[model samples]
Target: MIRAADIQDGRLRGDEPRRIDPRVHEANRRSRLETGDVVVVLVGRVGEAALVEAEFHHWNASRTVAVIRTREPDEAAWLNLWLGSPAVRAWCERQATASTLQRTLSVTALRKLPVPIPPAGLRAHLLRAMRLLEEKAATNARITECAMQLSDAHFAREASDGTPWPERPLASLVHITAGTAPRPRPDHDGAMSEPGTAFVAPADILQSTSPHLYATERRLPRGKEGRVCAPGSLLVASREDGVRAVMNHVPAAIGRNVLALEPESVSDAHWLLHELRSRSAEMAATAQGSAGRELSRKAFAATAVSWPPQEVREQFARLAGRLRERARIAENESERLRELRGRLLDGFLSGTFPKGPLPDDQGVQPEGGLALSGPQGIS
Candidate 1:
């Protein structure tokens, strides 16, 4: 089974290949993936999906996956982003069938889902904006990778030196806390949650490969839930033994199965987050429980972390901080661009975008050989 975790890194990352029976591969000719197809999970985690690249066209998809073939390349790009949007995800949740085992979506239902397809002229503007925003995000990802490499190199150098750094139990420097237990689910027609105050879950923290949060789905009225996590506190997943950590950019009501690390002494929160990433193996080893792997407060507080001299730790933090700050700026810029793109898309698809047809001479040609012109002239 190709579970959601396989591509939870925000893309299909594995390079391993598997053999398939020719008979099984040919059985679903109609659904066979082609280059640039967008594959979505049809069963558990229905909205979890990714844009398939040319290299994966030869590979077959499991039945849990659904393939979306767009009429135009631009449309495929639009669909990929749209499918990941909060609006679309909410719709999927409402339509999904839930059982004791898991939730699943049907192809027929997905096909019938309404989408506001824009006219050619406005679509061209949308595609232009989409390309620019996506490029910016890709740039930030590259920068983040570089920052991670630098951090790893520093740790490697420290490890090479003789005499390990003095270690201290995590409780000595930081307080370990878990989130408020989730209340019972509201009746289908009743509202159990509200927006504005973010209610963060394990999956939300895991979405970012870095030690920071970019997005989430759960939210509540301000202060509705206990264990309110302020910006800069580190968070780790406790549900199903998910082993990832991140720092919040805003105050959020912590959800069940999430642990928050609050700095109480000299240990810097940012440095602590990176250190936690380095000791993930030890954290995983302390995972407790059976039905769902739970890391108890006792286990969390007992985690031993290296404590280097204050001056050395501060120096390292200063160097690493510069790289992280630069990457953070790029990430923030890209996030803002994505939000703007979503708004523009919503307007264009709804026929509310301030534009009508433009003169032939004023038309702008997109890279795809299509010209898009309007009252706004593709602004």
Candidate 2:
């Protein structure tokens, strides 16, 4: 068993692959892992795994299982697919034993888990599908990176102007509206009845993303009389926690901890949203109170905001709008791809159908080249 200190936190590193500790020499280490070994989280929230395509060092582990050296490198990829499969995830969940905080898988139980090894042709087909998915994901990443660069450029231009611009307190340009705590309703109909409306709390605001207004909790119809936000208004969470206390992509009615800023000019919507996102940290820092720091409407209104030249603001609005649109497109495509991958995993792991077959060609193609093949009946 490896120590938790030796295992790098995978969540922080994104997709970068690393290795287990190499310093510890053990003759009978039953499950020795190496470069390209797939590591799966088998014991806890099972099925989360990454391919160890590079070498590193570490030792701490509890719920994780290190895939030992397999007969083929491609088998590691196949294992990743299996581990990610919904069926296997559910199975892992059933096998888990819970402690006070989390459920975990035991090593003996993991070794006894069943796995399907498809025929060579079917295996090749599955790999081909995965390769295509990876290619599409890479393309999506490039587009996202480009959009981020564009945002950086826009901000860079704004930062270059040295002249001090006129400032206006936030209150001057917009109305500060606060959300009310409504009585709890047992059903959606009850919540949306007279004087109730859809409201967003601080947790509802996802910073740097498009507006997300869907709330799990609904307010009574009577409560919404003064809380309805216009379609393009800026909603910010005043409470400092999570993505709340930041600007969101969607316009939502304010909850108790959120403040809605209605810009004087509709044209300034994009600019204001971008500005709020950029200054979220500063705003949060200035919020009052020891615990549950809050940004009062008066305080928020008193906050000074630099007013750039009208033309500059408009230019920023245009650029920001385009960037947001691109991000939305990328986000939608990514969602679709993820759903499709999930469906593929479900089908592949259920043993209901044979794995898809690869094309006749076997050798690796040129880097960044595309390959096409006939589609199966499955959509």
Candidate 3:
């Protein structure tokens, strides 16, 4: 059965249903999804919506999700896009009620969502354009996935099958240090305020597109830059699981429970990153502590890491680098397509989209032509 996480960014995305027990799902056949049907999340973290593309046609959803079948099947795509729009999201939030820690949209409230029904012919251009862009973005995502898989395979092959190389202590390759957390200052309104300096925590680096240091929600006031990690340094989390390593591409101050490593060999930074990622599971196994897994400076320094020959390192670097670069580019294009879809919603719903053979100013028109079919997944 479908769960909230299976519905990603306005698209139903799971290789298989979350619950595939034929006994349970078959009993709820009335709610079984069909192609072009839309699923809107109703309980906890509400307002997330997705279209049931053909791939998920045989699936059924949990009660936490509500399915809607539009009057005109072709308009289902538009509804999905609209549900993901900022206006719709805001409206859903206002309509939601809090129960304990979970916030949800009631069936009654969800049913009343305002839907603008554009002339069927008028939507053809916008729908076709979106479908074409989705296909392009999906193709990019698939290629990126393939490239990353190939890179991982080659890395594993070289590590286990290639000629053996000497192992080296991590301490020999990099200098590691801990970060400090600055206390927040209280404002006149009695709320704690951030220091202007971009103070980072383990959580911020978790979703970074590139392995680079990006600005995060945490910050220190102007003066405390003491525990700073400059660009090219590696920021590692103290904990064993989740996002463990991020290359601080920009100069940023780090908070407590994090370690910053500066590689002795500058050019080896990216290669080191790949090696660490490949060995993430191993690193977790060796971490210290029963209460909460923590990686200490001493433990980290003592850890034995592969020191493959220069040629082997170079080969891995080239392969991983190309894959990462391609993935980054593909992800960026996907973001752009999302932006274009949002623009279409703003224009079409607001009656601003050009009526004739699409205007050059809009930059998105079906004139280039399209064959609408399915949803897309991003990297």
Candidate 3 segments whose C-alpha is farther than 4 A from its true place: 15-22, 26-32, 41-46, 60-66, 93-109, 168-269, 276-304, 357-379
Encode model 3's per-residue lDDT on 1-379: one tens digit a residue: 6765566556666753456677766666767778888888776547888888788886777777877776567767777766888777777877887653345677677767776655556667677877888888778767766776676677777778856678888889898887766533324432225546666665455434345454564456666667667787888774445326777656678765567778865446766776776876677654566623455778777888878777777777777777777777877788788888788778875667756544333343432211222111111
* lDDT (Cα, tens digit) per residue for candidate 2, span 219-297: 4455334546766667776444321333334434565656777776654766666566567667775466654446577
Q: What is the C-alpha RMSD of each candidate to the true structure, in Å?
A: 7.9, 11.1, 8.0
Model 1 CA deviation exceeding 4 Å by range: 5-33, 41-49, 58-65, 70-75, 81-90, 97-106, 116-125, 183-196, 238-242, 265-267, 289-292, 350-379
TM-score of each: 0.74, 0.56, 0.64
In model 2, what lDDT does residue 190 have? 17
Full-model lDDT for every candidate: 0.64, 0.54, 0.67
The weakest ten consecutive residues by lDDT in model 1 span: 370-379
Candidates 1 and 2, the one with greater lDDT? 1
**What is candidate 2's CA lDDT for residue 88?**
67
> What is the per-residue lDDT of model 1 for residues 151-185, given as tens digits with 9 covering 90 to 100?
76786565456757888998897878877745324
Model 2 lDDT, full chain set:
0.54
Q: How many backbone clashes does candidate 3 have?
A: 4
